[model samples]
Target: MKKIFFAFIVTLGIFEVHAQKEFQGMAVYESKTSTADMKNQMGKNKEITPEMQKLIEERMKGMFEKIFVLHFDRSSSVYKEEEKLDAMGGQGQGGMRMMSSMMGGGGTFYKNVKDKMYSVDKEFMGKEFLIQDSLPQLQWKMESETKQIGGYTCYKATASKPVNMSDFRNFRPKDQSKEAGKEEKKETEKKTNFMDDFELPKEILITAWYAPEIPINQGPENYWGLPGLILEVSDGKTVILCSKVVMNTKEKATIKAPKTGKTVTQKEYDEIVMKKMEELREMGNGPGGFRGMRMGR
Candidate 1:
């Protein structure tokens, strides 16, 4: 597996040199993260009402059920949401509607597999940010497994990533007060942090299925550098599957890198997003928490 990992990395460099002869195509990936597992796990929490738990679980389930497009021409590609909303709804309405949009928007993500660099066009609240960083160097262990997706044969590969529960900040209830924050944290810690596995596993498995027929080392998100194009991704709770692939068309793709926004690395962007959610939590808690959902503040 380690040998295959090193070989794939070297192969990416070779593909970069022959980019002029590579195929240019587009793929559509529909992502759906199951809520059943999380819903069952949320049942054990005593601090949250059944109603609030259900709301949280449902919101999370919807967040990942979005559509994304990947336009790749050899070493470079852009992966971004299909439904690019022009305006965030109900901005001054001052309700969960605005906050929901704030928490729900999945930003535009771009990757240059040859350079091993990534840029994400993200909008938090009203502020825009350009998240610039290198792609994660995942050591994927090739498995002697195969699957067929959209008529293309795919091979399986798996790797482990360090788990951080803090990444799911949008799903967390807005902090209303200091006491409320502690109580909220205590409750979440008791039953598992926003889902099962709050105990913090050293690492979580990331499984990817890629089709060698498509020679580009690109995928729906920042996942690339594999021997082929990735079609499916699984992270225990969330699963993103490719439903369609379109190639060799007369369509012009705008796969350019985003330039406008405050510049920040991936880590800095994450910190900014999390901080905004925390502020929203306080806002929601201010006037009796999300229309009587009981923020535990």
Candidate 2:
């Protein structure tokens, strides 16, 4: 009886130690560059790239859109809730709404990720890779440059992507009005945009910060794989930061994928998305064009 009690206490202690070991940190990102055209009161016809012309025609083929942001830690990962924002007003809403609609309704909201143990070995592109299932299978190397961010020492890393605009496909809304006149349908067709392919950005740079006091490796928004917690990530002009950090808390932490969207490859989706945006722009005015549609009435 004494031996059994001793063994039980030992096992319990092991479980507690494992449970307390978790990596958590906050990340923040700020917009540094955007490629959208920002002009006012221009002529009706403007010559665009052949690529832009193609995007104008493919805008009429889909019913839903979604934007996904990934998050990661060393051992496990969780996809945070995705929300859609209305892009009609030139607002900063990305593809979150269309994705939410495709999932049925609402969005997935989570407090944090909860993985206790993670494998240290993983492979990517035939190379020995860091074992992070929650992050993309891309390469990252540390740079000599260093700086202080959010009060933590950070190192710079760079990642690059070729131009590939294939992940957007939910922007086009088809005509549903059966009793509408033929002229209206014709007009919609004339305003449509189509694309043959999408392009990827030229490069991405990440400047990550790690907290030496925190022993676990984790950070916000699909970033991991450093000796310490990363508090910031950036790609050229785009930057994300961590506003909060928690080492060990008593609350139960659960990490799971959100069910609020349809699954799609990035390439197949962005192609449709870019085209639909162009089509909407070609509508001359906004969705229910009254601001610019009437001349003398």
Indicate which candidate wins on TM-score: 1
Clash-forming residue pairs, model 1 = 174-281, 175-281, 175-282, 176-285, 180-297
- Residue lDDT tens for model 1, 100-145: 2333235667888878998876655566677788888899999999
Q: Evaluated with lDDT, which candidate comes out highest? A: 1
For each candidate, what TM-score against the reference?
A: 0.70, 0.47
RMSD of each: 9.5, 13.3
lDDT of 2 at 120: 22
| Alpha-carbon lDDT, every model | 0.66, 0.39
Q: In every candidate, how many clashes are there?
A: 5, 43
State, as a TM-score between 0 and 1, how close model 2 is to the true structure: 0.47
- Candidate 2: where is the Cα deviation over 4 Å? 1-74, 77-134, 162-202, 212-215, 250-254, 278-297
